[model samples]
Target: MNEYKDASKESFNDDFCSYLEHHLTRAFANAEDELVQKVWCDGVLMPFFENQTSKKSVNDTKRIVTKAWIGQDGQGEYELVIKFEKYSLRKYARGSSLQDCVPSERTLDWINIDLARRTIEIQLT
Candidate 1:
């Protein structure tokens, strides 16, 4: 297990999210040298439903990594777990129609990596 404190500087844009993804990908790549050249990875963010309106769904805005770890389960499957700090970037300026809202940091979100399956799964809010 590894902790990545301040993995990146806080930003109003999605740059922080991109940085987290890049670092996570690198960690995945470094897990196993034998599978490095042969592995292919992909991921999906399951749609999130709003609590107030079940018919409406929420989208992810920004993310930052706080911790990560690679381990083998009882089944001998390698798994990578990443804990990320989430944020909501105000798309519109306060009291304005323009998309210029400041970014606000939120709580943590989790991402699970299956090295053997070459897939990533998000346990997001």
Candidate 2:
């Protein structure tokens, strides 16, 4: 994983969120490598709900969407592959701290956005 503590000073915006957003967008837009992350689903978030004392769903907006990329698992003959990841702090183990907040797994659900064909193919399996 790349560290954000030592990137170009000018490339960062005044707002930290904007800085992360801009960097994430640029990172996705100019990627020259293949990235296949471990996937997660609603099941991954289940423990949070199960352990909550209150009878409510997780309505908080404390997500970190810094990892976006084009995967390379089966790159040949594929086009316009991308991934937008959202970090889940609640997915960490009990008593885990900030270090556990980082993404360590990902899954694939293929989605194709063909600009020339102007068609979208989604495979939710």
Candidate 3:
């Protein structure tokens, strides 16, 4: 049986969420913003696409914000859903990175990490 199907439904506390957010931030501290966004989405969504039941189309333009929080997965263990939002380039956008893009107000995607299995999953719309 798939481990995800047998996993328990539990919520991670605020401390754990904070730890995860910090961890991801540190891991990608030297990387470019676009690279960080790509890594998170690819890491989490690859498994979703490999499953026979999934048939969702992903928008690659979304960017990850390195912010994570506990989120329920219905049947499986609670996951850390990393925030991925839309970003658009503006000529006047100022930042340390030359390729900086302005982030949208709302999240456009999520990448869920299951700590027990060290796996990532997401529900695509």
Candidate 4:
């Protein structure tokens, strides 16, 4: 059983890596413009949503409220804060069939965009 669990976990990681590689490759295909890449990456808080929350339905109401910013020291580091209103699961279910609907908790995710090397790194805290 343990061996099977380990294998399953490894498979999930492998699949996730493959998915990320494919997605990022497609996203960066025409990413010649720095602002375009920044906008595309920063426009949606994918990292935060992917890492912080276990609920998949949160994406329905979540949106990026701000743009990415870098510190004054030019450290190749960038940060963006996203804000969304909180809702209750019961309230959401009132009009929809979704269960466990609730106001999303305010969350902030920081991302580092390296324009020189054309790489994006997410910091999980």
Candidate 5:
């Protein structure tokens, strides 16, 4: 199965929400506006397309952020719902050099991402 196949409702609620909030914080890190703290990710309605590149056997995927809704709740918190085209792990090149398999050497050509979010979020204590 694909590595990202487990992006279920629970994952969206528990994982992706916080992940997006963190991403939002970083995206606005260099900005001078007050929008950063007011941002929050509430939910998602993701519908994935077939994994077109699965047959190719690479370990990265590409996604398109299709839509985003941002608004303030009646309460003090802000809410968000982001939509995106489903993504699957991208395929590796057939003629890649042996060293290319090293993660630091391998590049994900599918999506544009912030350098801070590029590092793994979970680490052993």
Candidate 6:
């Protein structure tokens, strides 16, 4: 009476693939860079790692960025919080936050620097 008893391995695999594609599409909708999507598709999603976190050092501070979306504050300023080991930093933006998550490697998609606005919009494919 097991739920998977009647299902073949191939059928189960296909179902899993379909489910993955659906969730990937949803994730990509909010993604700002094609590189991020590719990394998710190849590394995280394919490997079944739903959540991921990365660390980077800037201005002598270790910053960490995760897969979860950091919601905006009441002042309409969106805070992109990153964690570095035990410490965390928050980067604020006026509009939506960009895809700045670190992949498996140290590579990062460089976006145009706008110091005046303090924002960077990543161009997604």
The prediction achieving the highest lDDT against the true structure is: 4
lDDT per residue, candidate 3, 1-125, as tens digits? 66553110111123333444343434333334443333321121211222221111112322222223322322332332322223321111111121222122133233344445644432222
What's the lDDT of the predicted structure labeled candidate 3? 0.28
Model 1, 1-125: lDDT tens digits are 65632212222124433444444444444544444323323322112222311111122333322222333321222333222222222321111121112211121123345556644444422
For model 4, how does the per-residue alpha-carbon lDDT over 1-125 read when each residue is reduced to its tens digit?
Answer: 45433221231133433443334334443455455344332122234333322232434534222223222222333333322234432232233322222111121122334555544543221
TM-score of 4: 0.28
Count steric clashes of candidate 2.
6
Enumerate residue pairs that collide in model 3.
none
> Backbone collision count in every prediction?
0, 6, 0, 9, 5, 2
List ranges where model 5 is wrong by over 4 Å: 1-7, 32-75, 86-125
Q: Write down the TM-score of every candidate.
A: 0.28, 0.18, 0.22, 0.28, 0.30, 0.21
- Cα lDDT tens digits, model 2, 1-125, are 76533221221113422332233333334433333121111101111222231112211322211222222221222222112223222322121222222222132123333333422232211
Off by over 4 Å in 4: 1-12, 30-112, 117-119, 122-125
Which ten-residue region of model 1 has the weakest summed lDDT?
92-101
TM-score of 5: 0.30
- Candidate 6: tens digits of C-alpha lDDT, residues 4-119: 43221221133433443344334543556553343222111121222222112321444222222211211212222232222112321111122222221222332232323433
- State the weakest 10-residue window (summed lDDT) of model 5: 116-125
* Candidate closer to the true structure by lDDT (higher is better), 4 or 5: 4
Q: List the residue pairs that clash in candidate 1.
A: none
Model 3 poorest ten-residue lDDT run: 89-98
Whole-structure CA lDDT of model 4:
0.33
Q: Write the per-residue lDDT of candidate 5 for residues 23-47, one digit (tens) a residue.
A: 4444334334354334332333233
Please tell me which model should have the higher lDDT, number 2 or number 6. 6
